[model samples]
Target: MARTGWLRWGSLGVAVLVLVVFLVAQRQSVDVSYGQSPSSSGTVEEGSAGELSDATVPSVEEMSALVKASPVVRLPGSTAYWDEARVNAVIGDAHILVAPPGLDEAERGRVRDVEEAGIRVIGTEVTGGAYQATADTLPDWRAQFATGDVTNLLVTLAAGIAKRPTPPDVDGFRWREPTAAEVEPVAADLRASGLHVAAGATLAKVPDSAKTAFPDGALYVALPRQPYGEPVPNFGPALVKLFPDKPIVVLYGEWIEYHGPREADFASVAAASFYGQAADRISRYAYPQGNVLHAYLNRVTDVRYAGLFDRPLPYVPLDPLRVALPALPWLFAACAAVFLALSATSLRRKAFTTTGTPARLAGLTALAIEVSGLSHDPSVVRGIAKLTAASEALAENLPDQHVRGLLDGASRDLDEVARALGRNDYLSDVYLRGRVA
Candidate 1:
């Protein structure tokens, strides 16, 4: 019996060791430092051709020259979309791409003229009732869309997307999420079109199909927030989780209702790091009016982020930090509970414990909480105050006048920290800094 028991335990230990070794080897097999390469370096899947690999990217140097070409091709979203100067400028400066709200006859003609000039024109579709919303518009759209000048037709989904069926049977349809009731109809249409059916998803609201529906499809992401707004934290992993097997194309619609101050444009660029990894193609809107708008164009198209444009304009990505933020309170709670428990037990009834371990622990933990952007935490402030008291109690043993005075001064600073952070909302350390004096 003793021999059998020893053998059983030994077998279990060997199995556990093997499992750990396998896990480590698997992790080391792939490049895990994804933050360094925001765009994927071409990863292929079993049944599907990836989205990034699907789009033909020209040389980075050529793209850089195109972006630097000035005055760059500029097109307005509204009435002035086809200004003569803008039309003349795009001849060699840029490609003509169809996009958004609606493409008109003259604007389409201008796009065609640019195409005839050897410029590659991309066709875009705005979906969700807009496609088939009117009977007459559909036929006209189909006729214009047939021109080989347009290589791809992207369908931008609206919030009201579910209410409408996606248009079927276009040669170059960038199909995204459609209503559940219309999925079969949409899929049936795509099956007959002999076109690649790719998918488009947004950040906050990803459709179920992105994960399970389109294993072989290319991935297109509509950035969750406006260019100026911060995206969900850890947006990269979130997107990969949703569509693991597809190539990703990021879209930044830097449209402003009323373009604001310089600071707002600056805000748009702050979210660009999210695109650093896994993005195959990035596209932006063609809005020409405000400096802020131009700032957005410059932020993406400039040499710094070269080769990311998906045409019309350049694209930026969303951040991943969004999902990580909500979990921070839990982190604070865990840290607080552990340190507070340790402090209570170790410092019970003592003015100061030996080595001042409990007080130091509390102070460090509280400081960390504040650094994590939770400075307004009332419990953390109270904990710091209690620790300060403990430190003062330790000072009682110091008979040296200078040492005691310094200790007293430190205690005063602790008191001020406690007072400032007693509220609910976060107040910047800068605002509270000199006010204490």
Candidate 2:
């Protein structure tokens, strides 16, 4: 009836409504599934093919030698397609470009023919550059270094580079950047020994295309720098597509300068090494072209190398602890919901015990009286009176005999209390009679 009572009831109604809305909003917002896309074979076509040729394919022994000797190995057939002029231009005065075994005619032809068979191939130059350079260059030998007049050697060696026919038993020399002090001495020794040499004048003259792939100048462990130009990436992708079901383990190699002289000593001396730079970038979820496979490869593949591995990329099925830990938060939320439901049920039971049940009924009757004044219509007041009578009838039938007796006494006094309030009398004749009794 008073202003404070109306304010209290109105505030309680608003608070209950707001709490319900907030809980519904929170339940709708929770998401359990990963937002990361499921692995799909993006634009890569799986196909069947027979073993075409093994003649030019490097033997396991040859690959082992190449992997150990070379600072960087270009995949498919680890060979640089650079002509002598391109080699001299990139390496400058002090360099020995070890020409390795390249793709054979059968393999190079396969690149062109695979598409005719309905397989999609990307990143291969259709023309003569990479394919022609391989057939033209000498394999498994000390390639001619810079010689005589700097301007004339490029023209002279271009024709002679592919003319050699010998395959040496020894492994090819591994190419490395020579310091300024070591340049002239190495060139002089190669020239004296009658080996054609690339002079020191052209160090880094030709910009490497591989460098362009990574504009930020952050070097990747898997990306190899070649003197000629970019290697044809078509071969690796084509072969991978043939055996789409097979799991291929790709291993990345670090720059020779990053590791110690001996493998056993295995310490990284440079901060810009593979472990330092590339891994750091990748750990921050930075993938080139937004491809995780490309991030792992450190170079973009010609095809989407997805669905190749049976398990997901960065697979962690082997670690149960890792899997379970991430799920613990969601599990805890489920448990909390169950706990709150049980607690509310238990509190309701406790509140309606013998003494509490009668008190709650009386409070409900008082609440009905307060709500009756909110509307002027007599029907609304009649409805409130009927609801209070229904609540009293339900409480009287509760199994507890003690609770029923208490409810009956509260019901008997309710009419006299209502009459005293209606008469605006704090001490009326009915209340005096009850006190005397």
Candidate 3:
């Protein structure tokens, strides 16, 4: 029992040790690099004058000597080689440089230099108006715009601009009245589609149309007229109030302009007014130069209000010790059970036995009787036969003659039984007497 208990405990301990090892092996740590920029282009310090030499700044004579250059320079998004010198050269001869609106500070500086050279910098803010304009004329324009194919529309408009004999007016620009033909088709389409069509002569003209277009609907889209100005002081907020129930989509033909001290404030006001009122419902479409504007709009639109936000922490792998400790009690209990079972089985086997003295003695005496009857070799049957013959001789040597004779007959009968028993024929010879004869 003690041995079995020790063996059981030893097995259980080994099993638990193996389990702990397995669990430890299963533990793993995951490395996560958060907040690191994935760009392989490397980081550029802010406000670095990239690839532009100071000597490249040309004098008036140097600038005047250069031939008349095209106002429109095709500046690819990243690899434009745009320096102050090349920008000045472009500005030197052209009356107006028409590019996309919403230039960064560097670009604005470049534009300012160009404007200082008596050249006008016309930044086109292509808005949803262009989409609507094209949609009115070309039915596929809306679908194309929805799929972000404004490049196709820009190409078409650029082609149109290239073919124009005279440049479009920039200063003191008035909204070009849409022809009756243009307005009529759009109005008819809106009515047919059960959608309201609102026209704005300028940014100020949007409120009335917005109220009439969307009274209780979730969304209100206002398509502004051509040549929209930069977002100014109270204009964006006041326009937002006009559509209290719905978000407004503002579309401008020209890039919105901002200048002086009010630029940041106006941008903030514009963003806040649009976002606070409509949240994500407001979207602006500006022509050529609205990429920055679109980026800003996307930023503001992502703002979400928090009430009771809860999120599960990311799954961190548990330590091997921590995981194994919780299961230790169960493992110990299993080991204990195994030990107990082994101990109980050993104890039961030790307590009971069928090969004790009484059973063995009874079996041996029966074998002697059976051996006396055996006809096999003397050497094989000699021991049991001698014992039986000695018993018979002892009975014959007794002092009482009758008792001695009876004892001798009993011995003879016993010899016959022993002989039968010796021959492995116990069933034929051995019997317990019920009555003495």
Residue-by-residue lDDT tens digits, candidate 1, 1-437 = 56644553454344334334434544644433312322222433422221111222233344334435533332333211222332342233333333332333344333444321223222222222223111122222222221111111221121123333433423321223334453343334324541212232122332333332123443333422221111212222334344453343333332211111222343234233322221111221222112222232233333223333222333437634444445444554444444444434434445254434333433443443443253433434344444445444544654445433443443444445546656322232333333334
Regarding lDDT, does 1 or 2 come out ahead?
1
lDDT of 3 at 189: 39
lDDT agreement with native, every candidate: 0.33, 0.30, 0.33
Per-candidate TM-score against the hidden true structure: 0.21, 0.21, 0.23
Q: Write the per-residue lDDT of candidate 2 for residues 79-174, one digit (tens) a residue.
A: 223344443443322212221222334444443342111111111111222221111122211121100011122222333344333222222333
Model 2: residue 259 alpha-carbon error in angstroms = 8.8
Model 2 clash number: 11
Cα-lDDT of candidate 2: 0.30
Flag the better candidate by TM-score, 2 or 3: 3
| Alpha-carbon RMSD of each model | 22.3, 23.1, 29.7
Using alpha carbons, what is the TM-score of model 1? 0.21
Q: Candidate 3 on 1-437: residue-level lDDT in tens?
A: 57765696585466456555545655855545332222222233333312121212233343333313544433222111112332342223333332333344455344345432233222222222122113222212222222222333333333343443322311222233345554454445333542333454122322322232223332212343332222212222333343342343433322222222233444344444333432111112122223223432433223211111122344567766656766654554444345334433443353355333222223333443333234332322333333333333433554444433433344354455445445323322233221111
Candidate 3, residue 275: how far the Cα is off, in Å: 14
Per-residue error for 276 in candidate 1, Å, reads: 24
